[model samples]
Target: MTSTPPDDFDAVVGAAPSAVTTPTLEHTAEHAAEPRGSRFDDWWARTVYTPARQRLWYWGAPLAVTLLAAVLRLWNLGNPHVLVFDETFYVKDSYTLMHLGYEASWPADADTKFNAGDTDIFTSAPSFVAHPPFGKWMISLGLAVFGAGNSVGWRISTAIVGILAVVLVMLIARRLFRSTLVATIAGLLMAVDGHAIVMSRVALLDGSVMFLALLAFGCLLLDRGWFQRRLDAKVARRRLAGGPADWGPTLWWRPWLLTAAVLLGLCSGVKWSGLYFLAFFAVYVVVVDAVARRRAGIPFWISASILKQGPATFLLMVPLALVTYIATWTGWLVTSGGYYRHWAQTDGQPWAGALNWVPLWFQNLWHYQTAMYGYSINLHVPHPYQANPLTWLFMIRPTSMYYAGSSLGQNGCASANCSSAITSIGNPLIWWAAAACAFYLVYRLARYREWKVGLILMGLAAGYLPWLLYTGRTVFQFYTIAFEPYLILGLAFVISLIIGTRTDAAWRRKRGLLVTAIFLAFVLAISVFFYPLWTGQQVPFWYWQLHIWLPSWR
Candidate 1:
């Protein structure tokens, strides 16, 4: 991607024109022709895409880099030889769903047999699992091939999706910031980050949620770019060639946004939390569209954006999500013998025969859903490691997913001291800085009305802040997986800021980037250094203790 320096004074490059370009309006006039993607086409489209004129590397390099991430995440994979965290739930459930057509309960120690490649004891009954079946269905895809014997069966799908997510984030960051360097950095950070790594290795519903939600987010960004391009092209055709171009650009059936909605619904199908992000982003898309329309100077932009954009987002997300969500319950629908297979028939509700001959089991499933919703909202249990969302940014507490007893000699500990632990502690270097960045984002959002700040805040709010509303819940630190991607992105955004301001002197800016790069290198080194502890690698006690930066970490 060879190109010239994009100086603030180089005409049509800065919000604040260079002192040199000030006395002469020559520079601004020339860049006005540059369009979205770079400094060449309709240059005045600063608020939108800038057409790229210089040499640029394609997606090949990003793909290769993503493969490297996959190697790290998927290698070994089945160590500790046990379900690390919620794998206990998702892995076993997925196996039953595949074998029995519904999630059925297993013995208390079923993980031991399942780990040892023995699933013969699992029954052929519909299990009363809480979550929707999509995530389990995915897990079962791997188990069906790998046979639920080891972590490979449970984890391979998630690990693959996790690495693919890195690729998606890179592609997304590349488009959003218009910087290959930023995109690579985001991918590189995700490659080794603790939360992404740990979650990938465990067969957890949250990781699936993370993958689908992030996928949807990525798709919407692309959809935004595609929509704007069509809008501009349509407007140009009308103004230049003379036609009404009435309906404000045909962006009716946005495929990517629809993909996002299906993914979002599936995400909620995995867990109810996806509903919040779906609701938020649906509105977010419409608002972004309206603003883009207004800026483009369409005569009836307001009505057009609402009428055209709003309904499509609704159609894509709400109904599509509902359908996908319902489909996840088909296993319950078809089954005659379930946990609550006859509640409506026995209790004899008015709508008991509403879908007459639909089977009493199906009616009981609906009743179970009503009861489940009640339980989820009214949950008020307190917990020991229950962290406040307020403290999430600080990495003050991390969940220990596994710990076992063994002598130092038995587990290869150097001085008769043995310790085996899989903790969900985040990279301190990245997280501590992100907390400061969060405050900075808050200030910038209020001052400049920057959309970047708002996006980060919204993600964090949906992931972290909402927990404030449920301070009474018995949540654990491992729940951070829900929002860890945004946290990582927040850190990456701050690092971009550290890479020097466009307003800084050229030499100073270069130096700032150098320092930032070195800082990121250290963070990467730390991730690799602690990889042993993050996964259940057998390391000496003293070696493990060295990684414990605080007493709480120990």
Candidate 2:
């Protein structure tokens, strides 16, 4: 008789079960002598045969967590009603981009005038912006819908993207760990984390980069599974034809990879740091393909993947990404008044000979891009909240985006002094714990060689490691928002290990569950404590001081 599969079986093994089969003793013996074409048959079987009832949790759980994220990001979004931190640049630029088709130069008193409802203070002359226009275009959508002077309008698009990011994290975690509970834990952490909260609530380009990079990561994860299934089928066909598995077939039709390329291009269009993700993940894809081929018993897996398939993958991803990146400048490209829009025709020399055929507009764009790159790399201006990337993961020196003080009788203040502030600080327990978990994951990846662990670490590396080269370039801890999702995912992975398996001793299972519950409760409690600071909520000056655990945070 065949037995029922355990509900938590996938949780323990980190993958779906192979197809279940009930066969006679004689039939089982006969099949044991035959060669199987591929190892993924069981995975396909389990997937195809999954109960309809179990599938509801797949969408249901993630959507619930995303609802929590929406509430946190959208509540009182217009509080303080002023340009906070870098919003002085992004929000004003977005307002002008909506009106003028590109970022236009604003007068010295533009913020004061714009805040006082004089929203039309920009000139037609282009501003030399450090970042690209895609993120600003997104912000322009919100400004268009709600009017430019409304603070909620200034930040609604980012809030929505932030909510969607929480759902993506849940879905990706579900795929990686094969556990809905673990996935929910990851989403909850991101939902309540103060850094994610502040980044979502403010109008900044980094939030767009974070969401796009994460969406690209999700696409890549989907591609990994799709590639494996297709490779298995092809390998099975070859083995059935009595052929040697010398090299795997090159599979070119990858929709997820193509989607990822476009997303990464748009990401880079928002902020150039997004290119680091594309570069890192491209290498990761080639490595994963080699391993997949090796697992399918290909004798020449390494050379076949590196030499034969690598070029094909590059052709599929890089050129498409470049095209997409250029397409993001449509507004600037078509318009005449953008910064350096006619440089090649006037101030700069255009290419001669064969390259002379290139359009003056295209050459002008190239010149403008190079200038933007030079400015970004060489920037060393000092600011009070500028943080070293080395201390980012620890939440030391969190950036203060906005702050206002009130006397006892002003603005509903009840204490001798009151404070309302927006601090981009992560919850202390969650951040410190996630940091410790990330270090442990590095060891776990080395010891066990789990692809999921490597993938999570790669996400962290893509968002973070590149910044180390520019420590002198005036970066801030708030930039950590880009990789903060991966940190929560890493934390979730460790939590899975702590929760143990249903197969473990009853006492062990109970202890694990109890511990996880207590930890989550504390995380929730800390989120409540810090929510006031994360938003610009007024509190007693001493109470606000209590929330600052470290001197550096102030």
Candidate 3:
């Protein structure tokens, strides 16, 4: 203390070193203002070892992964020399509609002749068919482009759309999970699934339904994001102004929602059952909006959404869908001989306009819908392959699309006892694991509030559970395409848990990643093993026999 007292004799320095002091309070504010990590904060650094190279993981890897998926799906698309499954119905309907301008009745015993490459059996005049022509419309496009090319023509549409679906899976999974790895995983899984591939190679409505449902689902996801962002910006503005945010924030009219509506209309145009997804998703969008409002701390959010947002959403979705559905009937409306085409001209009519050319026929369509409803709801026929929702996971008694035995030396015969057939079986590893994953999801929904668990549950519910209630109706597991995208989502969710969301403790994270890699490898391997059956390849009878793990599979 004595040594520090000099400063220009009185002030050599403004203050002696011993007298100088720093304040302990300076760091108080820094400590208070520092950001404490939420559980996700340490995710990337802890789990993703490549820190400076994060961009490569998202963009570059997905492109590479998608290529792998494409090769698996697109190669050897033509195998079965004959139409597989219901390719007979949709493919032939497409041709009949194209040639006749409407569905024409077939001569008795037409299939034997038609399958013989003789197209002369379809008769003139309208044939009363149950389903609308839009699905056939799409099938016709494929045939027109790729006609009678055998496997090429019959399966072209499904193959192309299946490829497109892989692209969609990448986009949806990337957006939902925000991880490129998760998206690539989803795409790869979809690409390798035996059911999806078999369905793709055959002309069927379920693949188209899958496409439309996936499109609408993607749109709803986009709309939810847009709505939430609009809320956030409004909240930020209010906070900056030092005032509580107003409850009514202006929302942009969402075209994606409209796109979703129109796609659903097209879906309904294909099959009336598509309306179920439209109804469920329409209500789902409103609930999502309400939640977004509540999370933004908007008081009276329920009424705010119900009164202001709900009507606009409905107008944009349901009624617009109704209008589009009616538009799908334009061809029928123009034709007088359509099955119910005379409703307006019938002697006693409830709604009048026949003389105006718009006709009571339009009104009669309402009555026709009632009849269609009865047929769908009251259908209770038992069949060998009529599997219940409880057993769908196992892929037992899978639907056989086509079966014929060729004597040795005829077409595909590697054995003295020749066998040639096509069976629409699922990839056992992927589906079985999905079942286990879904079982886990069901458990977690009761115990933990996981977003993936709940969202995936909706799709499975809409597609599978509804069928359970309608078990009295003729239903099949092949219809599961309605929910395949979400099933993939559920699988991706489990993958996410295994990978620990790009962040986790060292041991847990390592184990999770190992499991994901192992599962993916196993799934791809299974796809290769089943590629013969999926594509109708002419493997030896014994080679085909290798895939029939169960006696029921026969």
Instruction: Name the candidate that leads on lDDT.
Output: 2
lDDT of 2 by residue, 268-306 (tens): 999999899999989989998999999888999999899
Question: What is the total number of backbone clashes in candidate 1?
Answer: 19
Q: State model 3's lDDT.
A: 0.71
Go through the candidates in order and give each one's C-alpha lDDT.
Answer: 0.70, 0.87, 0.71
Q: Report the lDDT of model 2 for residue 154.
A: 93
Model 1 spans with C-alpha error above 4 angstroms: 1-61, 231-251, 298-309, 346-365, 500-504
Model 1 TM: 0.83
> How many angstroms is residue 502 displaced in model 1 relative to the true structure, after the best TM-score fit?
9.4
Query: For each candidate, what TM-score against the reference?
Result: 0.83, 0.91, 0.83
Clash totals for all models, in order? 19, 2, 8
* Candidate 2, residue 546: lDDT: 94
Task: Tell me the lDDT of model 3 at 124.
Answer: 68
Q: Any idea what lDDT model 2 has?
A: 0.87
Model 1 lDDT tens row, 101-217:
777878778878877777767766556666677888888888877767756878888887778878877766665555555667777777777867877777777777777888777
lDDT sort, best first = 2, 3, 1
Top of the candidates by TM-score: 2
